[model samples]
Target: MSTPSRFKKDKEIIAEYESQVKEIRAQLVEQQKCLEQQTEMRVQLLQDLQDFFRKKSEIEMEYSRNLEKLAERFMAKTRSTKDHQQYKKDQNLLSPVNCWYLLLNQVRRESKDHATLSEIYLNNVIMRFMQISEDSTRMFKKSKEISFQLHEDLMKVLNELYTVMKTYHMYHAESISAESKLKEAEKQEEKQIGRSGDPVFHIRLEERHQRRSSVKKIEKMKEKRQAKYSENKLKSIKARNEYLLTLEATNASVFKYYIHDLSDLIDCCDLGYHASLNRALRTYLSAEYNLETSRHEGLDIIENAVDSLEPRSDKQRFMEMYPTAFCPPMKFEFQSHMGDEVCQVTAQQTVQAELMLRYQQLQSRLATLKIENEEVKKTTEATLQTIQDMVTIEDYDVSECFQHSRSTESVKSTVSETYLSKPSIAKRRANQQETEQFYFMKFREYLEGSNLITKLQAKHDLLQRTLGEGHRAEYMTTRPPNLPPKPQKHRKPRPRSQCSAKLFNGDLESFIKDSGQVIPLIVESCIRFINLYGLQHQGIFRVSGSQVEVNDIKNSFERGENPLADDQSNHDINSVAGVLKLYFRGLENPVFPKERFNDLISCIRIDNLYERALHIRKLLLTLPRSVLIVMRYLFAFLNHLSQYSDENMMDPYNLAICFGPTLMPVPDIQDQVSCQAHVNEIIKTIIIHHEAIFPDVKELDGPVYEKCMAGDDYCDSPYSEHGTLEEVDQDASTEPHTSEDV
Candidate 1:
């Protein structure tokens, strides 16, 4: 029996099998990997199912919340002016904490006692409860309304999504597809983890789809569905316009951003994304749920515009009059305390006046002293002839010393004066002359008539006098010196309806009740930034003129410049009145800063002030070029600025923004230099191919354009909106069916 008579049969061959352990181990490892793959697939499916069920639970919570609101009405009606505690009990049912507890408890019960720390069921339960919590967060504030029909509609969408998910696995002609993908992902994972052992830990995997045709069919099906959805969405938008407008207090921004971004509405008149969806839902809701689609929409734009002119139309009047409540924080008193304390420009003017007056006074006194000295000199001349032998007066050099002192005081002043002041005046005068000659482009709204201009000038002069005293920016000029200022019939200063400008002086009575009262410093800084970006346009969401109030006055000085600091006068008030020139003399293509802003555009052409101003004005008049330019410009500007700051090691304006995939979290000056060069080169190339787009914009002056391929290929989003050829190829590699709304 010694080892079965020492290897006789082929099956029992035991001539010291050479390392069959390694082969056996290899087979076991393969089997292990297969098991892991199946496990992962199951886990993924279960997770998806849980997410769907969680959504359903959320719908339940929403329905319950709505019921509570309905019950509140009933409770209020039934309380015959008595029984406070009972009424409180009814209200408690709606309390967010209680609602959340009930929702979670229901989930726990539904989970069949299988709840554990890592339990999928428990996680689902928790997710549903969290959604309910969001709804009940602040009773007075409305949560996202998930209506019954909407829930049903979302359920339908989930079913569709599941169908597509299932199709992915079945679509593969060969079962090896999922396996292949798993292998690929595992390979990537391995590369990342830096593991080189013979796969000691087998990863979970699933059957992979191997057929390319199956993938194409799935993609085609998805495209067909998406197209149908788009059509339905479009119909829904037109139908639900009224409904959307009605929810103005809530839906305005959402409606604009979500829809307009996805469509061409920014250029042509069209419906938004949600509106289209709502339209499709209209007939369905009306037919099935008896929902009135018309109930939600506010007055349409045309009606709103007409209503605005009607001062008595309580909505507009109430809003304008009560401005504080509409904004926020209701701290008018605090704002008043913070505003216009420095009034640098105004103060500087006062200082200039005082200095002038002092000089005049000194001149008069000096003249008198000279006359007295000369008279004394005449008499002394006769006396000096006799005293020449006695005194021997030495020659004096006082004049030279006085001149030297005067020149020294003005040394620092010269550079700023010559560069900033003289340049601005010469440039502005030229622009004014240009505007005077050209008439088609006058801001017709501001120019009523020549007579009005005269009156405006008179008012401006009076305004100047009021501002000149004590550096007070808040004070309106005392009523124009009425030389019976022949009021050739006052036409009312561009009725409050016309002027978009903010009140320079605080209308404390008006803004005291606003709910969104931002600090004056924040307001001022934002305004300055906006103004720096462009000044012709008023600020966004701003009620006050904090930025404008900060002028080239003595109080507004640089950090280490004591003389300027003590006085607060550095920037000239009118220096930046017109557009700044930006030239792009490069080789790429013409792109420029023009659109997507609600206000002043800073696009420039390196010459002519009014031309520059008019050019910028025309720029944002519409969404110019294409979405590509807009996306490119914004990305470049943000990335460049972010990188430039990083290189300098300065704190970022918004550090969280650096987390985006395309974001260079801490891009430095190197990125900036590279980006800048690329942009410049594009401009040059565009000039060469000037005939392509802006055929009229000749080679004499180049146009600004955003350049990607800068910053070491920032196109890493793996998706494409404004994309390069390489980026598009990468995007195509990701099957659209597998992608989410992101």
Candidate 2:
């Protein structure tokens, strides 16, 4: 019982514990391998089920298609004398034929002889194929679900095994540390007392150490045993959980699959109940092509038999038997020729009556013209008399001056005419300056003759009398209580009044006349058209065929064609609108500059209407002379157009909306459409109150091109005026351009 023996015992116990732990690890490895194998087997089974389902579905689909083709081919065949061999050969397709026969019989039993055979066969085949496909899919899906459940169970078991392995390692490490401590204690005792029989004290110490060491070994073994037991329990629990999961998944799969199978079978039976009857009918019809021919032959034979009857009684009986088979005899009517003659006579008489009516109307119109001539003569005379009254012509006789003229010699004439050379400054100032002396003499004569002295004396006396008082009398006389005050006229000062009328003029016709420029005939026509129709319709009516109208206007003006051609059909509202749009756009500067549109809108919100109008005037003045001239006419034209009632009355607001986009610069039509309302408000404010808004502006008085050619300073605009307009005019004039070019 020395130190060496205790150390040896500790070593033996450590070895036993290590071996036990190793055995437990080996068992865990074997269980894991078994679980892995089972998982692989389940996965393979699921995969096999899927492949079987796919194959079955494909086979069923192919069989259904084949059955359909088989039925159609059999029905389409000509069973002629030469087709018996072919019919026999077609029997090789026994699968479809057998299916057809089974479906036919099933329909007969179920339908109680109410269904056709061929249709029933087809329906049954299709329904059976769909049912089988659905069943196989359901079975495969159930198997797959079971496999998934098993996999989850295995995963849980593996996780628990990992936990057990970790715990075992922890316990093993503790046991190893205990053994090492026991070994160290023994080693230290041996170093202190090496011989077994050294002393009783030494021996007692050694024996006590051995006993303590043995107790420690026993305790370590007990702890190892307990750890092993815990590991085993964990394994057992994992196995039990896995079994329970598997059992539940199996039960669920079985229940769902069977339930689905039963339902699908019932659905197939219920939905395909008429299949057999439909099949029988189709088969019967396929064999009945000669029935129609036989019916017609029977009708013909009956007709021949009826024709052989001689007695009237027999004929009546035959006709009654076949009421719809005979044709009724025709009866001729003799009135057809007389009816034709009457229709011709009526047509001729109507034509003669229309001619007579037209002749009488023309004669009446001629008589009206003669009466109109007499009225016109009276109107002319009255117009002349009115002119004479309004404007007077005076007669002046200059015969006396002409008669008094005398002849003179050149020297005498020169001396008489040069008499002013003898005059001095004093004499010139004092000697009766003709105008001053004459007026002065006349004033003295008038004062002396009209009792002026007496009136002066009386006025002096009255003033003295009035001044002698406290001035109450003077106040009474000077300030009369009963007199009314005169109203003074308030005049707003105009900034520029080069050429303007006294009144606020909206007459566009006067503007055209005052312009003194030859506007194209088409342009005038377009204006008329716009005023006539555009005011009524707003944006609805456009000047149709603008290109042609522009071309015609250009041609007529440039080529000296008749400006007042009677045919005005070439001009329309749209064409006029286009021309106006072009007039603005063709300027050296756009009237509504794109960058300034928003700024103009901001200016419109100014509280003072005059200031806002002034801002708008400044914006308009910034445009080229050509643009201003067109804009002036356009404003007047719109003013005239707006004078109407009800529906035809186009206000400034509608006019602005109609032309805002057409006149202004926009990125696109879509932006224009969106901004139209804003444009309408702004333009309406400017145009309706243009006289106030643009108080100092005036329309150009001549053709814009002529002004450009003359190098007028005012024609300059922000866009620059470098004779581009002059060049354009020259090009337009020289070339045979159409109105469209304008």
Candidate 3:
């Protein structure tokens, strides 16, 4: 016994197999469609992102431009008048104004970052997205085409299998028919032989011969039929074998398609598409992240500037700038009428009498104010109690009281009717309550007024007493002996310079000489610390340090102490940078002397790079030896800093913007405002071409130089001690005399 076939017929098997193939094809199509749809969506998403960033960048650019214009306009307006000079002198005002300027610059920087982000999205990110989408689409199409061809090939094989199966069935039916005919012919021949043996009918020799001939013909026919059956059977077996082989081949192809080929196609389409999308999205995210980081850095700079503003410092600066305006007025003297006879203004008796009288007046006023204050305090307490009682009345349960009244009304109907008839009574009660509340509020207001009056009286008394004491001190004291006025002697006034006690605001050359170094200790320490710790810190110089900390560090340097020698980990990088900036800003003569400001500006404006660099080198060589050496050291550090611009975001241009004014201050005049851009450009050019502008000198290198370069404690370098001062003086003598020299 054999197991029954699962399928009833070959047609059913073939139909089921074709159905599976169709399903697989449909699945492949669906997968391709899904991939295409995802690709389209990703492309659309990228496009939207691009548009968003572009518009955002436009907004940022416009906003930044407007802010820059606003700052420039205000700065111009301020610089056009004497107030600008006053602001420069007044440290308090200068700080906030500088902060405002810095704020505007930071915003402009952020806007530029946003604009850059927009450009990246449009030029780089979007282009990559488009390319990825194209590749994905192309891949999907190619996969789809391959899948369709594979399905077509499978269908052809299936069709051939069906044809083979049909031919096998035809041959099998012919063979069955031939075998039936042969069996029937053999049965007829048996029937004829039986009739001859039974003798049931007349048996002649001719009849027997006819019967034998019939039997012979039947046998011949049977033999021929048997031969045909055999032939049909062999053909049927051949057709069956062909059908089986075709079916097996088709099965293998289908199996391989479903297990390997289809999966590979799907993976190709899906994985590649997803991978490309992932990469594109990651790129966008990275760009966005960097943009936001830059924006935050800019904001931090603005915040630091705002935090460093000092109102007290500004006030002190105001006083310092306008000393005459803050001078004490002369003491008042008693003036007598021309016809009147009165004591001299310095008479002790008259002064004593006036002081006693003022003291009495203040004492009387103070007593009266005390009494009034007591009265107002009591009244205020009474008013507060009344208000509290009113609040309690408002919180009473009127509904419960009404129910009790109704219950009593039923018991005393005649009394209730009489009470209801007198509605004016209830109205009178409500009016009384309102009157009491009004009185309470009025009492509170009166108490407040009385308290205010008492306070004013007390203050008046205090002021009167103070004035009396001041007058007594002024007039009751013995006057100094009057002497004849000395004859006026005209003498030349001495020119003002920085105070000798502090390190800052002094001559840079003097400081260099004192320190016995080519670079000041403060500058060298700051640069070294920044290089060591701040290479990756964003917005190093742009962000301000704590004013208190900066001042502390500055004081340390001024006091001949190395503040940075202590644990550097606790030192803020911005604070060090701030100290450095302050050192430059406080120089009596900027690193680039004021006389050569125009020359430096002109050098930067030259069109040809080689010519500009040549002129810059010449101008730099003309600087005092100390100034030139320091500039070289500073510019070298700045150049090195700019190399890490990607991390610190302090490129040469940004650094120049921060340091330009400090190194080459514009004269406090209206004409130099337009030259500020050139000044910044000059500084930028120097920073970029520092090697060319300030070539290394062999004589400058020493143990101190190495120490400075290595971020060690500052020591006297060889240039300072090796007869360099005479050369510096000679260089200075050649330049036109400026106010700084005085």
Span of ten consecutive residues with least summed lDDT in model 2: 408-417
> What TM-score number comes out for model 3?
0.35
Off by over 4 Å in 3: 1-43, 77-101, 196-202, 294-742
Predictions: Cα RMSD each: 43.9, 56.9, 49.9
Which of 1 and 3 is the better model by TM-score?
Answer: 3
> CA lDDT, every prediction?
0.29, 0.39, 0.56
Residues 220-265, candidate 3: write the lDDT tens digits: 8888988898887666555554454444445555545543454445
Mind giving the per-residue lDDT tens digits that candidate 2 earns over 1-742?
A: 3456645654564455446435434443443343334335434544554455445445544554555555445444523323435546764435665565455433223222112122222332233333334433433343344334433433343344334433433443444445555556556555444543355564577787776676566556556655655555444333332232232333333333222322222222222112322222222232222112355455555434433322223323433443322212111111111012221111123233442343244334434544554455455445434433321212111111112112211111011112123364235324323332342333223322222222222323333342334433443354322221211111112212322311111122332344333443334545655544454444422333456665444344333333334534445555556645543443333457667777776775675555666778887777655446656656656544543313443455555655665566554423332355566666766655554444233344643212122224323423232233235334323532111101
Cα TM-score per model: 0.17, 0.23, 0.35
For candidate 3, the 10 contiguous residues with the lowest summed lDDT are 486-495
Write down the TM-score for model 2: 0.23
For candidate 3, what is the lDDT?
0.56
Candidate 1: which stretches are off by over 4 Å? 1-120, 127-550, 553-698, 702-742
- Whichever of 2 and 3 has more lDDT, that candidate is 3
lDDT score at residue 627, model 2, on the 0-100 scale: 43
